[model samples]
Target: MMSSVINALSVDIEDWFQVGAFESTLDRADWPSFEHRVERNTDAVLAMFDDAGAKGTFFTLAWVAERYPALIRRIVAAGHELASHGYDHQRVFTLSAEAFRADLRKSRRLLEDAGGVAVTGYRAPSFSIDQQTPWAHAVLAEEGYAYSSSVAPVRHDHYGWAGSPRFGWRPVDGSGLLELPVTTARLAGRTLAAGGGGFFRMLPYEFSRWAVRQVNAEGHPAVLYFHPWEIDPGQPRVPNAPLRSKVRHYANLSAMEGKLRRLLRDFRWGRVDALVEGMTA
Candidate 1:
């Protein structure tokens, strides 16, 4: 039987240099010195999505939106949702409640104003909303965000809220916001990332494909994400990073776009706003 579940295909709108992996190596102040490749790369992805007749949410950086307003508008013009990735690409856990709230409010306002859409979604940088930051969900709700795709639910050194739900839910303690975690598949009682970013690049396309299918078979939408840089294998490569960081950022760059195209063709996709339509509160 054809699965009725519609999966989310999302793009994080930040320049290659703005990725959290490179944050220690490059400061926000130095971001201007490095050439940014997000606009051109996102245009390419937008073209591919246009060709596939696909629409997905874009969790965009406020810095990118402030500088490249037209790109965010183009994303909305293409019929995708516009959401916040916070200003400056800072992680939720790194900031205090007041600081996090300020960042969240500012970024949401900027995204909505610049993109000409009601920005209702957020995804913390590096999926860093975890046990350390229980206040993250409350702030998201208080600041008027309707949903967040900010938890990975798997354990990792940098991020991931281990043992969290794989699907969507409002926090028991939080007031209004909902959580749409990144897609994951359980095997032998361990939760493995289903698809997107480094995982998508590192895994065989077949594994990524099967993982999302398994989620859809369970009648839930799979929330998958990627970045504009993932498709740009020709992008300028940064030098002298830690070996692991370099591997995670650059692995299988040439093959990323093709896999994304296949995923688009193989399944049904749409904006996150649509993905939650008729969803229970």
Candidate 2:
């Protein structure tokens, strides 16, 4: 059965080499040396969404936007929401409150200027906001961001708050900012990652389909995210990256587009801003 709910779809607009998995092997200073495939890959994503007649958010990095202003314009021209994914893809927990604020301001400014739209939504790199960054929400509100999708409420090795709210809520007292967590589904008393990522590629498509249905059956929108690099199987590989990172980054790269197309056809998807407005309304 098709879900009556309209889920939120998002693309984390970054290149293959810029992923966290390659952070150890690649340095920020040498980022310019890598082959720039973000434009080509994101164009593929936009084409897919266009074919599906879907409009979603693009959580763009200022680094990418600064280098590829034309790409930012294309995203905006296609009627997708342009949101911030920070300046350089740094995790919130890794930065102090002041540094985080600085990142927020810089990213929001760069993205807004590049896309010519109000950047109000943020998704921390790697879903990095958790209990340790209790002040994050307050800073987001102060910085004029209306909402965030930075928290993944599941137990994971890298980034998950585990016990955070499963849906959108005001994380800070007296603040209107909303934290829209990446979707998770309960199965056999365990919280599993239902949202997109390497997990979506690693796990069977049937499981993801069931998970989205599970969330929709409960009367909430499923927020799914994926990077442009996920569909690029021919991307240059980092030989020095750890085996775990390589597996996570390389597994099912060729299969992502097909899975994503199926998911889009199976469920209704829209921008996160629309989802946030509906939840608040």
Candidate 3:
């Protein structure tokens, strides 16, 4: 049976070449040279959501919005919440406090201008906000963001702020801004990632379904996310990239759409904004 609880679904609006995995190999200056596939993949995602009658959030990159203004408008028109995924998908810990704020401001202005909606939520690129970036939540609050989904509560070489609260909490003292960590489930004394990403693509669909059910049974909404590129197997291959990056990026592209459809039908999916409202209320 499908869970009655509404879990938060999110799509990180980015292209395949723009991923952190290809950063070292692909220069940001040459992003325009690559074939842009985000629009087609994102449109496919929107159609998937429409078919399932589900609503979710699109954490958009201002870089993409600048090039694809019509795509941003299409997302808004489909009733999905629009949020920021930073100006160009820079890791939060990589930038100084002032630079981070500037990135946030730039992203918000572009997204709002392109989509014609108030952008309140944010998801750090690559889930990069952690203890080292203590000023992150404060910066977010100062920038007028109401909430952020930037922390992943699992250990990983690339990014993860392990031991953080599994659900939402005010990361900064006295700030109303909420930091909603990606969903995680405890299994046999070990914490496992229940949220989406490479793990979702690499692992079996049944495991993800089980994880969501476990989290829902505990009475918390599971916050899951994936990139628009995850569903596009035909996306250009980056053969020169590291083997690990290649595996993570291309492991199960063919399976993602089917798994995602099952996930949507198995749970009541909604936008992150609604989940934030409930948590704050």
- Estimate, for each residue in 1-281, the C-alpha lDDT of model 2 and write its tens digit: 78789999999998888888887889999999889999999999999999999999999999999999999999999999999999988889989999999999888888888899999899999999998898888999998888999999998888899889999999878877899999999988999988999989989999899989999999999999999999999999888889999999999999999999999999999999999988888
Error of 1 at 266 (Å): 0.4
- Candidate 1 stretches with Cα past 4 Å from truth are 172-174
Clashing pairs in 1: none
The TM-score obtained by model 3 is 0.99
Total clashing pairs for each candidate: 0, 0, 0
Cα lDDT of candidate 2 equals 0.92
Model 2, which residues run further than 4 Å from truth? none
> Model 3 off-target regions past 4 Å?
none
lDDT of 1 by residue, 1-281 (tens): 44567778999999989988888887789888888899999899899999999899999999999989899899999999998888998988889999999998888888888888788888999998999998888888887777889999998887888899888888846365788899999889889987488999889999988898888888888899999999989877779777788999999999998898888888888888777655742
- lDDT for model 3: 0.92
Q: What is the TM-score of each candidate against the true structure?
A: 0.97, 0.99, 0.99
Model 1 per-residue lDDT at 70: 92
Better of 1 and 2 by TM-score: 2
| Residue 235 miss distance in model 1 (angstroms) | 1.3
What does the lDDT read for residue 134 in candidate 1?
87
